[model samples]
Target: MDSVDLQVLAAARRWAAEGRRFAWVTVARTWGSAPRPPGSWLALRDDGRVEGSVSGGCVEDDLIARMRGNRLGGGQPFILAYGVTQEEAVRYGLPCGGTLELVVEPSPDPAQLEDLAARLGQHQLTQRQVDIASGTVTIAAAERGDALSWDGGRLITVHGPRWRLLIIGAGQVSRYLAHMALALDYEIIVCDPRKEYGPGWDVPGTRLVTTLPDDTLFALEPDARLAVVALTHDPKLDDMVLMEALKLPAFYIGAIGSRLNNAKRRDRLARYFDLSEQELARLRGPVGLAIGSRTPPEIALAILAEMTAVKNGVAVPLRDAVAEP
Candidate 1:
């Protein structure tokens, strides 16, 4: 979930705790150009106040009007559709007659929402199921080991910390990578034991760790939402942490090197670390797409683009072997 969802949920909990009644609405489905995607949520107070948004403004306005007239109350959930016609679409600012579907559940059990918040605080992906007939909700643990599964009956809300990037070096390339990753809402940590690089390593919203790379990995205990990149090109600094990260469930593991250097590194890993072919294959040496990136920023962009693709479960195409003239 995003920050907006967190805020709305927190508000809902506060309202419920204060003995105020509110309804929770979720945009469960959309066709064409809905303002918000599925899983977008809104909380409506008893007096027609709302947090978050499902459409531009018209939908909220219409919902509020209904609420004031006492037509949308009681403790039951119902599905609503809007913008089925061009005029309605224009009125709601939906592009090209787009339609949106919402699930409105009144007086949601605050305890269940609070439980979800607690799980999210621990950085755990969770799935919440609401029985339409019984109006009961159940929360279950979710895994990032595989692609997200969308169940028609269950509202799967991913609850966790934002994605993270751990760069094992704090050089120029690391700075570029950190900047790009932050724009993508990733928490970044750059580690370097070298005092020269460590002294000037300051990036906003990025933590700088001057500890040894191996110890840093142990402390982090990286999970599937974390990606580790080794940009120092030093075996002493990079190899140990690479081994540690590979042992964990980090979604992307990569290192910067030439093809010849990568081959040598793999040989060393196989000889000393007992890494199998499959395990070694997980290490993307000569990291990033074959974009002919020669500068620090360009290379960083390529690496982050590749990481994003992997996180989204998309395949990276092999670059053409034919050299460009």
Candidate 2:
């Protein structure tokens, strides 16, 4: 599944292929409270078609009007500010007197769009830098820490997955989780040393590693942007991952099992593996929310839901498997 930015880039490329005129808008900066964050993308076709969004309904409407009237960027790139004043904020439907500075490209280069899309399709984190004065764009490799930078004359936006998810098993649940996480713009890496499991793994957009779980964890060099999930349900495999993962700085770490199974796993880690209480506290086991999920897909959904909540800094109670009747 393509992210909203990738979808917007695809739409722009499609319009270019069909010989259509379109304007591309990026939320370069925001003040107070804005609907979208910096680097949000929106494409406006000449016929009022829209892909993605920069603000609530009102901002898109204004962009559509400007596009239809041939007044968006006046044949070049320009910065358009909305909701600067309290009254203007209400008029534009911006919340809390928020303001948005958007960079509009009257005629974005089709070649540039295609290049960026190709790089992202190859699972490369790329940056597209646009010179606001000339509409000239340059594409380059980007690091995970790179962020969107707007200096009033240049706008640089990072594209592709900034977050990473490492799954220790390539089973059905992991397949579903990896597939779903791709839509959220996460670079997925699935590790399974068991030869039997490697042959059946067919999920695209995820890299499968045959190395030991601990080796995979070591190679990844877990950071705040990384998340590790164990789904093998094998103590030897899952515990191997947690032994090293819980010691790292990954933002989220989880393992799939029932409540009793996770409890045992935690005890084993503490007693044998020497995982600290604080480190073990970071492990989210019986992973996912209490969504009463029975099937593999539902379980995957719950996992992603919980992961999203944690990533957003939302306080979610620990999820435990309910006792069976």
Candidate 3:
């Protein structure tokens, strides 16, 4: 689940606990170039209050109108389809004839919502299954590779922290990276053993560790859902982590520095660490794309962009885009 989805759950829990009449909407499926993906949630109160999005801004107007008029839900779960025809698509503001299928449930169980939110807050992956015939929601353990599974009868949505980012420095760039990654629903952890960097380090929704980068990297043993970025320019801190991280199954492994410095770092790793050619190829130096970024935030954006592409299995060319030191 995304942070936005978590927020929606929290809001829904609060509203239900307050005895407010509300409807829970989820993007059960989409066809063509949909604006929002499946499992995106929206909570709408009887008074037109909303908490999340289903199609960005395309299909909300009609939804709110119908829900406010008590057209969507009463005591039974139901489905709503938008943009069934080309003219309907245009009229409803769906882009490029996109279609949205939604699941609307009225007066959901507040205790269930609270349990789901708490599990996600603790970073546990959970699957939420809604049985349309019975209007029941079941919680189950979710596997790492599980996606939103919807048949005509049941809607199964996976929620929790699905991605982890391990940053090997507590510097300014790492700060920006951690901040930006949080919005993208990544669990961020920064590891720096230096006492100087540890004293005043603080970032909301992120964890900072004082262990050395090498030890930290080994302990994580980063899996396919993890991305490792080395922001410290020092070879001693960055190289040890790289030497270990490159051999792992992590989706992304990158080091931050000038191209010249990265090249030297690569050569040194090859000469000293006995990393194979294939292993060396797995490392992304001068991390991120060709964005002409100069500031820390801009650079962080570029790094995350590349990481996202790699995570989604998109082959975007780098073209040697690292910013010059």
Tens-digit per-residue lDDT, 1-325, candidate 1: 4667778888999999999889999887788977888888899988998999998899999889888888788887777888988898888777778898787888798888889888887777787666566666678887664323334454545566678889998998899999999878787889999988988988888999989998998788777788999999889998988877777888899888777777788898889888887788788777888888878998898889889889888987633221111
By TM-score, the best candidate is 3
The total number of steric clashes, by the backbone 3 Å criterion, in model 3 comes to 0
Alpha carbon lDDT of each predicted model: 0.82, 0.88, 0.86
- Per-residue lDDT tens digits of candidate 2, residues 196-237? 898898888789999999999999777777899999989999
- Pairs of residues clashing in candidate 3: none
Each prediction's number of clashing residue pairs? 0, 0, 0
Per-residue error (Å), model 1, residue 45? 5.4
Stronger candidate by lDDT (1 vs 2): 2
Model 3 per-residue lDDT tens digits across residues 144-182: 788888998899998875589999889888988899999
Candidate 3 similarity to native, TM-score? 0.91
> TM-score ranking from best to worst?
3, 2, 1
